[model samples]
Structure formats: C-alpha cells, structure tokens
Target: MTQPIAQPAQSTVPASKVLDRVLVLEMVRVTEAAAIGAAKLIGRGDEKAADAAAVEAMRAALNELYMDGTVVIGEGERDEAPMLFIGEKVGLAPGKGPKIDIALDPLEGTTITAKAGPNALAVLAVAEEGGLLNAPDVYMDKIAVGPGYPDGIIDLDRTVTENVTALAQAKGVAPSDIVACVLDRTRHDDIITELRGLGCGIVLISDGDVAGVIATTNEDTGIDIYVGQGGAPEGVLAAAALRCVGGQFKGRLVFRNDDERARAKKWGITDLNKQYDLTELAKGDCIFAATGVTDGSLLAGVKRKKSGVMTTESVVMRASSGTVRWVRGEHRAKV
Candidate 1:
C-alpha cells in the first residue's frame, strides 16, 4: 500500500531558487533512504525485489520535500514502474517551491546487488526547469575523465587507441600508464582488446557504469578514463556530477531502431547525431547526490551495526560552488 504525501508550507519560493544551496542536503537524505532500502536486499539473489524496495523508499522520501519536482529521467515510462516514471510528478504537487528537473536511479546496479558486487549506488541529479536533458531510457556512448585535464582531452569520434594516446600525451605519460574502465560485455570485446594491446591497463565492471564514470574523477581510483555504452539517463546524471565536481564528460546517444529514435524525438531530442558536451547535457545551477548501496570505489555500502543502528556513506556535490561533501550517517532504530 502507498501513502499520500502532505503539502508543505507555501512560501512562494521556487524550488530552483532554494535547491542550489539550501535543498542539497535534503536531497542527500533521499538517496540515503533509497540506498538503505536496497542495502537490505543485497546478496538476496532477488534483483527485482531490491530495485522495487529502493524505488518505493526513494519516492516516499522525495514526496516529503517542499519542491515541485518532476522525474524527467527515471526507471521507465508510465507503463513501467508504478512510480518514479519518466515525466512523473513528485514532491508536493503545485507547491510554492521552485520547479526542478530530477534524474535518478533508485538502484543503479540491480545485478551488482543480487551478486553483492562492488560499485552499486543510488544516484540522483536535480537542476532548474529545463536544466537537465530529457533523455530517454536508451544506450549512450560515453567518455569521461577526472578534473585537472585540459578541455577536449577525450572525444568519442576518435578511436579508442587515439583517445588513449591523446590522454597519455596530455598527462605526459606512456600509453601503458593509463588505466581504463569498461563494462564487461561482449559488445566491448574489440575496444578492450585494442586498449590491452596498447599496453594500457583495463578494469572491467559487470554493472554500475555510473560509478565507473565517476571513478575517473578520483585519482586514488586509478581509473584514468571511462569509455563504453551505458544508459542515456545515467549519462545525463553523470554529466551533472562532473559538472558539479571538476571533470570532462561527453556522450552520444545510440539508437537501435526507429522506435528508439521516436522515443528520443518524443523527449525533444531532434538531433539524432548529436554528441552532448558537459554543459549541454547538464547546465545551470545543479546538485548531485549519490549514496552507496554496495561497497564501491566512490562510497561505502550501508552496514547494519550489531547494536541495532544502520550506517551509510554518501557524497553530495553542488555545481554552484564546485563543492563536494562526504557524509556518513547512522540510523537509530525508532521505537
């Protein structure tokens, strides 16, 4: 059973105005709730249950906020999940808060959770009206790198080896010094083989490409580059994160058929050959938050303490200030 959401105070303040600086913390709690929900189902061998719990918890947490939020990018279409669908209205409807565009993955890595793999996260990004891209649930060819690199360091049009050579040249290192991350799919066999033959190191991930993309930002992660095809919605979300933090990201949507192309057109995407740069994918004042559902390089997974308390790790970033925060929360049992 689902519960109805209560209306918040009517202050005539728009969500976008308040969200950049004020509501970022509240947004972290939303991802935390979703992570906790999914963490409970970790290693349960039921990916569907884990995803459902996360979607439900995330929806409930979102509805408690004061803003007028729309799920611009979500699980699926209206016929998909009962909630958090694309174009679904969330939060208090018609509230006095600003209108915000939300892109979220309640459970970014369902397969990772079922297998208790690394790099699973609950991630979301919020921007002002028309700030985030209205991307469909389609595959996106993406390439990303962490901060401090010159702009145009990575380009999708270039071959994998050429891109690696460019990055190596920019970093003043040998091609072998670069470490790349790619999804472990047969689709990437040639890409992986070429990268390996170039004397570059490759880290293969089963799922959770969002985390893999973000890893490029952390020098400690040793992921010099991320190149592969992942979700378009996720591509927008990652671009938002890179926008907040310092990084370079570029993505191009991949369509399988006319139906997929039509779906993109339905979302105002007319440029079938468009390659989105960072600013184009996510722009304006934006906030990004991600909480770990399973232990990964970006954040730690939720843990249940022996004393009846639950702990979780989260990272929240604001593009307005280019500030990033790491949060550790402990949940005490309620009577």
Candidate 2:
C-alpha cells in the first residue's frame, strides 16, 4: 500500500534567491533516509524492491521539507514511474520557501545493492528554478577531471588517449602514470583498450558511473580521470557536484532511437549533438548531496547495530559557498 502525499507548497519567493545553508543539511537527511530504506534490501537479490523502497522513502522525506520543488530529473516520466516522476511537486503544501528544481536518483545502483556490490548511492541535487539543465533520460558520453587543472582540461570530442595525455602532462606525470575510471561495459571496449595500450592504469566499475565520476575529484581514490558513457540525468547530477566542489566535466547526449531523440525534444533540448560543459549542465547556486547505500569509494554504506541504532555517511556540497560537508549520522531507535 502507498500513502498519499500531502498537498505540495506553492512558490512564493523569488527564484533568484540562493539556496539556504539549512536546506543543504536537509538534503543530506533526504539522501540518508533513502539509503536506510534501500539498505534493508541489500543482498536480497531484488533490485526493484530496493529501488522502490528508496523512492518511497526519499519522496516522503522530501514532502516534509519547507520548499516548493519540481522534479526536473527523476525516476522517469509520469507513466514510467508511480512516484518521484518528472514535474511531480514535493515539499509542504503550505510552507514559505523558494522554488527549486530537483534532480535525484533515490537508488543509483539497484543491481549493485541487490548483489551487495559497491559504490551504490542515494543522490540528489537542488537548484533555483531554471538552474539545472532539464536533461532527459538517455545515454551520454562523459569525461571528467579533478580540480587544480586548467580550464578545458578534458573534452568529450577528444580521443581518450589525447585527453589522458594532456591531463598527465598537466600533472607533470607520464601517460603510464595516469589512472582512469570507466564503467565496465562492452560499449566502452575501445576506451579500455586504448588506455591499456597507452599503459595507463584503469579502474573498471560494474555500475554507478556517478561515483566513478566523483572519484575523479578526490585524489585518495587514485582516480585521475573519468571517461565513459552513462545516463544523461546522472551526468547533470555529477556536473552539479563538480560545480560545488571543483572539477571539469563535459558531456554529450547520445540517442539510440527516435523515441530517445523525441524525449530530448520534449525536455526542450533542441541541440541534439551539442556538448555541454560543467556550468552549462548545472549553473547558478546549487547544492548536491549523496549518501552511500553500499560501501564504496565516495562514502561508507549504512550500518545497523543490534541496539537498533543505524549509522549513515553522506557528503553535501553547496556551489554558492564552495562548501563540501561530510556528515556522519546515527539514528537511534525510538522508544
């Protein structure tokens, strides 16, 4: 059985207002709730159950907030998803807050969670109205690098070898000393082969390119660059993260069928082959938050104790302030 959401809030404040810091912490709570919900289904071998639980939990938490939010990027369109679909309103119906555009993946790696694999996350991003790109659900070719590099360090149009070579030179390292993260998919065979032939280190992930992309920002991950094709919505989310922290990301949407092209058009994206940079994908003051569902590089997974206390790890970032906050939360059992 599903519970009905309360009437959502209307936008009364101007859209130009920057997102408040309080809202940033609230966003962490949202991802944390989603992570806890999906954690219960880990290793259950039921991907759908895990995803549905996350979506339900995330939506419920979102509706409790104080803002008027529209889901610009979400699970799917109205018919494709029962909840958290595109354009669905969230937050308290009578509250006074600024209008926000939200992009979220309640469970970024459903299969990974089902198999108890790694790098699964509950992720979300919020921005002022028209701040985040209304990216449609489709595949996108993406390349990214961490901070401390010159502008235009990576490009989707360049060959993998050329991009890696340029990045390595910028870092004053040999091409063989560079490390790259990529999704393990047959479509990326050429990318892997080229990296290997160039003698560069490679880290192949089964799923969750968002984590793979974020790995580029942290040197501790030993990931110097991220290159591959993944979901366009995810690319936008990653761009938001880089926008908050510091990095360079470029993405170009890839359409396989006429339906996908039409979906792009429906989203008001007319430039089918245009490559988007970091700011273009996610501009204006924004906030990005992610909680680990399964232990991975970005953050640790949810942990439950016999005393009924649960622990979660999350990272929340604000673009306006360039503040990256790492939060550790404990949920004590209710008496």
Candidate 3:
C-alpha cells in the first residue's frame, strides 16, 4: 500500500538552485540500468519478479549518484517495499550535494514486461528540493494535449467530446481527425464512449499511462490528446515529462473513500477538487528521463546481441532549456 508523506518544514535551500545539466544524462543512465534489469525478466510471466528487479536496479543506481536525494514518488510505504519506498533517502553520501527530489516508476509496465509487450519503460523525474508534487498513490483524473495549442485549450471540467472538438479546431482538422489516447479500463468507459460518439480516434492502451500521456507530445505517435484516470504518482511523473518538452496537463485527485482522502490530507492537500496544471505538479527546472524496456512508439526497446553486448535507447529532457536529447547506448557489459 502507498504511504502518505510527512510534510517537511520549509527547507533552507534556495529556490533558485538550478539542476545541473549533466544530471540529465545521469538520469538516463539510471533508467537504462533499470530497463536492463527488468528486460532480463521479459516474457517470464512474473510481474512481481520483473518489478522487484527494476526497483532493485534503480535503487542501486540512484544510491551511486553524488547528490542527496529523497524518493518522493517511489514504490510505496516503507513496509510495502523494503527499498525505494516513499521518503527513502538515497545518493552516495547524505548532506554532501544538492538536495534533489525524485519521482519514479522503476518499471512503468510490469505486466507488459512480464508478457513481453510493447511500450514498457523505466521512468523517473528529478527536480530541486520541493520541486515535484508529493502526490498520494490514488487515482487521478487527467486531461492533456500537445504543444502549440492555446494555453487553456483542454479543461478537466469539460466533457470529452467538447475538449476533443476544441482540439480538432485548433489543429485545423475535423473532430474525426483527432486522436485521443486512453487507458483500456472499465472506469474510463464513459470517456471512451464520448470520444467514439464524436468520431474521434481513440488509442486504448492496456497499461503505462505515463507513456500514453507522453505520446501526445510526439507527433509521430499521432496522439493529439490523452484523457482518463490513472495513478496520481504517474500523473506527476507524466506532468514532469510534459514540463520538459511542451504540453498542457491537468489532474484532480480521485478518492474512493475516507481512507484515501485521509492520505491526501496527510500529503498536505486541502482542496480535494482543485485541478492542478502542469506547473503545479512539477516546477523549478525539472528533468525527465525514460528508457524503453520494450519496443514502442516513443522509443526502441533494449536489445541484446549474441556477442554478450546490449543496446538501449533513452530520452532525457530538461524543462529549463526545453532541451530533449535522445541517447543510444551500446553497453559492453550488462547495464
């Protein structure tokens, strides 16, 4: 189960502390390590094993870094996961470097990896202290669109059809020409139905909402918008990705019962119904990094050669510079 984070007293760290550009590649290395770790378990049909392998690899890699970091969005509570749990401290030596907050999904698609499906990835985001939202592990209602549209083009409060129609008009295409990505879950049937009724194309992914949300920003994916409900932690991670490139994202917490609401309150959220934009979720020059564990639209999967060599594809982006770098690596040894 997910644990609520204890709000810390305002840190003395200056708000202007900029994340070093080199950390971007470091993040790529971290995700690559995790992807390779999980890739070894691909098609094994053991989701738990795959996820545990990823968590172990990612935590090991993070600990080798030179900064003082906290796992804001990690596996779960200290009791739920022995390592990489929320509030777990990482990095080489504490108090020796910049204070960084990390939000990660060691393996974004556990079932996908277990089944050797496409679009599996190892994902994480980093920002200066207090930069990322400490979102509880609960459902989040989300709506997002790619760049070049008006600032307020998509609203969570609006109907799916209306948002899709508005996006179509902005792209100078008919509603039927618009493509929206959504998770294939019973909870989103209403959203799927509305898009179908509007003649909008829908991409229903079985998992990995982070990739689904990020797909909107990549024109090659032909995904104009993404809408539905998913993990709130993934929502913050996806928002970080959009922050680095260009996009608009809005998310509202969805609590099913009193316990869920109590978790939200523990994380310092008072306005349960308040819609959060991209900046609100991630702020202050954050970095987003992802490595494909399996082939998909966003990136190529890790490939192993017969010569005991492995290749990985990753993308690392920084919000401050709006710089996005695609890295292709050939690891002489196992990542």
Candidate 3 — which pairs collide?
none
Please give each candidate's TM-score. 0.94, 0.94, 0.94
Local distance difference test values of all predictions, in order: 0.88, 0.89, 0.88
Worst 10 residues of 1 by lDDT: 1-10
Lowest-sum lDDT 10-residue window in model 2? 1-10
Query: How many times do residue backbones clash in model 3?
Result: 0
Q: Tell me the deviation in Å of residue 83 in model 1.
A: 1.1
Candidate 3 residue 64 Cα shift, in angstroms, is 0.5
Top-lDDT structure, candidate number: 2
What would the TM-score be for candidate 1 when compared with the true structure? 0.94
lDDT over C-alpha atoms for residue 236 of model 1: 94
Instruction: List clash counts for every candidate, in order.
Output: 3, 2, 0
lDDT of 1 by residue, 1-335 (tens): 11111111222222346474768898999999999999999999999999999999999999998888999999999987798999988887556777999999999999999889988899999998899999999999999988777789889999999999999999999999999999999999999999989999999999988888888877777889999998999999999888776778999999999999999999999998888999899888788999998887788899999997999999887777676788889988789
Clash pairs (backbone) in predicted model 2: 8-93, 9-93
